[model samples]
Structure formats: structure tokens, C-alpha cells
Target: MRPLIAIPARFSARTSALRYAAEVNARSLIEAVWRAGGEPVGIHPADTGTAARLARFDGVLLPGGGDLAPPATAPPTPTTPSTTSTPSRTPSTSTSPGTPWSRACPCSRSAAASRP
Candidate 1:
């Protein structure tokens, strides 16, 4: 069986085709995974049960999107203009897996630590 790679779809306030808010994934990412002989699955980020949810997948791929809200303890920085009107499209700092949010999701570390 092909490896099932779990990719978290980004939450968006609006999308062209959808009347309600939507979850979006990158077409290039999905196609690349398929070309590499793996199946890519997009998942919604839940408030709870993250571990139980991730345990079923063979791997994880984190795609970059969304605003970068700095930690409360960090020194303040000047505000920058948002790129788009949508709340989800605000100018983001680096969205690499090393950001503060990763600490909340253990799977980030687990996926980075595991062997292929």
C-alpha cells in the first residue's frame, strides 16, 4: 500500500467557490506526493485529539499559510499591512515547523524525529 501522508489543510475565512469558510490545500503539494508514490490526505486542524488523529497516518507535511501571531512574551514588533482582505491572508512571518505553534502539536516533533 502507498504511504498515507497527512497534510493539514489551511483554514480560510472565504474562498471563491464556497459560500461558507473553507479548508484549502496546495495542488502542487498533493501532486508531488502522488508522483513520489505516496497518497496525500488533507485534514482539518482540530482543537483536540490531535495525537489520536495523527497516529493513523504514515507521515505528515505541514504547508505554510495564516498569520504569525507572536508569543505574548516576545518583544513587540511594528505592524505590517495585510496582503489580502481575508483574515486568513494576513502577512505571515516564517511558517516553518519551528514556530511557537509547533510546541502545541507534538506531531510536528514526532514527524521530524521519525525515520522514513
Candidate 2:
């Protein structure tokens, strides 16, 4: 079966409140996939039938994006709060593990292909 890839694109109006939106351009990714011998399909998040369509593809990829609310494994407060002083405490921020977003495409390169 010829490999098919689906790339997710989320474009917003220029004045939106996004601090650092994802920079994974769909056209570029699709081009790369084609050059690598896979059939790439670009998809948008608002596409209602994405799931049904992706079901026909080989694999699903979650591309790079801004951080979401931290995972629910944070540590609990160690000390009890006193009535007099404004409860002294510090909240922590979580960062992603810096995993490179895998480009979703098919594994189509053959063993005999010349290495560039």
C-alpha cells in the first residue's frame, strides 16, 4: 500500500492571543513527505471528518505545539497554612521535555535508495 500521511494545520487570525503558536507548516511538511516517497495529506484541526479520514492512514503524528496545562503529577503542598500570615507558598511551572515533533509521514524509502 502506498503510504499516506496526514499533517495537522491550525491557522489563526493574526490578532489572536497566542503567545507562541505552532510553526509546523502543512505545505512544507507535505512536500518533504512527497520527496521522501510517501503520499502526504494536509489536514486542519477544524476538519470535522479528520478522525474518519486518518483511520485510513498508516500512523498518526502529534506535531510540535505550545505547552498545555501540566500533567496531573505535581507535588502537593508540604506545610499547613497559618491564619495570621498570608499563606506563604510558591507555585511551579511545568515545561515540556523538548521532544522533537515527529513529522508524520510514511516509511517508504527503500534500502537501495542512494544516500544523500
Candidate 3:
């Protein structure tokens, strides 16, 4: 039996075929999964009983496309010019299971300096 892959459908305000708001998934993604010998299933984006429903599927494919919101407590902006500066340091590399290698700066430096 082929593995069942659960795909979370992307929600859009308006689509060309459907004039009203609708939940949809990419056709290419579903076809690719099927070609790879996996059964692709569309899942509703509801919070209720999601964990129980997903238990039946062998794997999950989370496609991007969602709203983003800033944190409630905003960081304080610097008003005064800084006189001192720290030297740039190289980022350290690490790897985890089933994930690509990642690089991160040491925690000793300021957040702004760490950003690429």
C-alpha cells in the first residue's frame, strides 16, 4: 500500500475559477506525490481534532503561504549613535536529522550584527 501524505490546503480570498473565497492546493504538488507512489490527501485548516485526524496519515507536507504578524512587545529602537563596535565573527555550522545544514552566529554578539 502507498503511504498517505497529508497536505494542508492553502487558503485564498479569491481565485480565478472560484469567484468567492476558497481553500485550495497546488495541482503540481498533488500530481508529484502521486507519481512518487504516495496518496495525497487534502486536510482542512481547522484547529479542532487536527491531531487525531492526522494520525491516520503516514506523512505530512506543509506548503508555505500564510499571514505573518509582528510581536506585541516591539523591540526598542536605538536613538543614540554607538561609539563602540564589536569585531565580526564567523558563523558556526551544525546539522540535524532530516534537515539541511544551518549556520548561526555565537550568542555573544548583538542580534542586529548576527543577521546576514
Best by lDDT: 1
Ranking by lDDT: 1, 3, 2
What is candidate 3's lDDT per residue for 16-106, written digit by digit as tens?
8887998888986676667666687898888777767776776555554445221211222374333222111333533233321122322
Model 1 TM-score, all chains together: 0.54
lDDT of candidate 2 over 1-116, digit per residue (tens): 45776666666554246665553455555556666666766566664655566666654333445652222222333543233322112212212222122222343233114234
Give all TM-scores, in the order shown: 0.54, 0.41, 0.52
Please, what are the lDDT tens digits per residue for candidate 1 over residues 1-116? 87777888887799888899998887877766666666889999775877678777766666754454433223433654333221221123223353322222223333334425
**lDDT, each prediction:** 0.58, 0.45, 0.55
The reply for model 1, stretches above 4 Å from the true place, is: 66-116
Off by over 4 Å in 2: 14-24, 47-51, 68-105, 108-116
Clashing pairs in 2: none
Off by over 4 Å in 3: 66-116
